[model samples]
Target: MDTAVTSTPKPVALITGASRGLGAAIARELAPTHDLLLGARSADSLRPILDELPGATGWPVELTDYRAVAAASASIARLDVLVHNAGIADLGTIAESSVDQWRNTLEANLIAVAELTRVLLPALRAADGHVVLINSGAGLRAHAGWASYAASKFGLRAFGDALRLEEQSLRVTSIHPGRIDTDMQREIRAHEGRDYRAEDFLTASTVAAAVRNAVDTPRDAHPTEIVLRPF
Candidate 1:
């Protein structure tokens, strides 16, 4: 008897917060093979990067808005990978944090991730795509005056874990990347000082490389989660 063989399809990846920092890095790293849909709140920020990459489309959508995310998701074809890297870190203790600050943190970090995943799950399921959640070390450990940001990340970690189980066939990984020297980290360092050591910081490109590795790994194998911290 003779057996037939088939080639697998090239994957498509949709990344949130692709304007700059880690999101932009992931887009650049994945541009070689994946058809990319880059989503962010600012169209201008994405235009230059999208212009440089091939087979990449830029859609400016606030992930916090479920309707906008849903509409944006509808415009895309089947997705082979989903990277949820868009997040905001608002600094404040639980008591000192304003109500608006807490709301904004939840909206940007937690709610947006959940809603965007819900919107994009169908497309991902159709292609057996992977979902990557960009979380933070704050999620795993407590810190001073980091209540809102920490809570948001913690929620995201739990959400990703639960979703991974629900989508047993799809690959879902939550990554805890310690202090990357992005604007986000700069802000945190400005307030925290030596607490966030400058020498012990990873570049956005490094995190992007990790994301690419996760996506490029064999489909038959799934790495549940990865914790990447600067050594």
Candidate 2:
């Protein structure tokens, strides 16, 4: 008698802004169990992460480019997870902010996210996927100098809330992490004229672990939100 062995196909996860920082950490966390589609603005930027995780494929597209985003999302027939992590934080007070600054911030952080999620809805529905939005503490509280960035994040939180209610079969989680110790955080510190201290902020891996835990939660429980702040 002959016996046959079958192997299960790994789940697929697409992570935007996966070339570095928290996005890259999330990719590393999920790489062992999920086949990854790592998104970055350019193939050159995504190369190092792609090399590190041989199982992942590069998805190079500007999120603000709706045409490019739609084209890229079309190739995915069944997506198990979609992590929206790409965003910009051009910090400025309302008095200092220009029309162009607000437009660019909203375009990258809010509009692009909505468009990408909209285009990938069909694929997500097919697999009863989980959508993870890497939000920020700014989403919950607005600081004086962070008007534009905070507004965009607040809009994102609303989007996630609406999505969770709208898509009954899918799970939508909004992860509100405080200032993380990432390259972005370094830039933010520089902008504020504060000394960069990695110890003062949440590590990318710690936040990434929170994401993985949410993704791994039992279907019976819905992890709608996860808030992480450094102690």
Candidate 3:
């Protein structure tokens, strides 16, 4: 019914770890306006979300695979929004945590993020895009048992900070939110020997809204860092 000869193309937004949890929530929030690129570890995992959201493509790849990420960036000529939402939290005290856990956490949370952003810089620069890092409350302050995860998030915060300083044209943000009612939280609760309490945590939708708000903010102003605590 609505036929304009040359309509402006919608801005493209790519969200990693978008198969579920906060990543899926972000995809839903942006679906109304943006051309979404839903990224996940497996295409099968993305089937459900792709079915629910029209016109969104599922990009399945290992973030740690530098070659694959480089190739994926090539397909995206212009990226308006890039969300670093894929991360793993290894919760344990320094004494209890192994070297492998620390390495794995840093590899996924910080190194991969940096690598992806580096590869995508050309596309982001073409659009003057915004980069959003989904950091944790632990990023601001490390908890006793969450040393390894906190370290990785803290590193992520630093990465965003440095990116903001180095790239004058791009907007970089670090979002620090408290524990959300996610499957990841359930796994954390099991490790802590506590009952899963969904009511006591932030919902993914709420956090996703915060992300959308930042993206919608006026270009004249930059929302550098946003922190969200459960209410």
What TM-score goes with each of the models? 0.91, 0.99, 0.97
Alpha-carbon deviation at 37 in model 3, angstroms? 0.6
Q: Candidate 2's residue-wise lDDT over 150-226, tens digit each?
A: 99999999999999999999999999999899999999999999999899999999999999999999999999999
lDDT of each: 0.86, 0.96, 0.94
- For candidate 1, what is the total of clashing residue pairs? 0
Q: Quote the lDDT for 196 in model 1.
A: 61
Displacement of residue 182 (Cα, Å) in model 1 is: 0.8
What is the clash count of model 2? 0
Local accuracy of candidate 1 as per-residue lDDT tens digits, 1-231:
899899776678889889888888999999888878898887888987788884788879877777777887796668889999988888977788898999999889988888888888788888887999999999898698999999999999999889988998789988888889887788887777646655679999988998888888887788777898888
Q: How many residue pairs clash in each candidate?
A: 0, 0, 0
Error of 2 at 201 (Å): 0.7
Residue 168's lDDT in candidate 3 = 86
What RMSD does each model have against the real structure?
A: 3.5, 0.6, 1.9
- Order the candidate numbers by TM-score, best to worst: 2, 3, 1
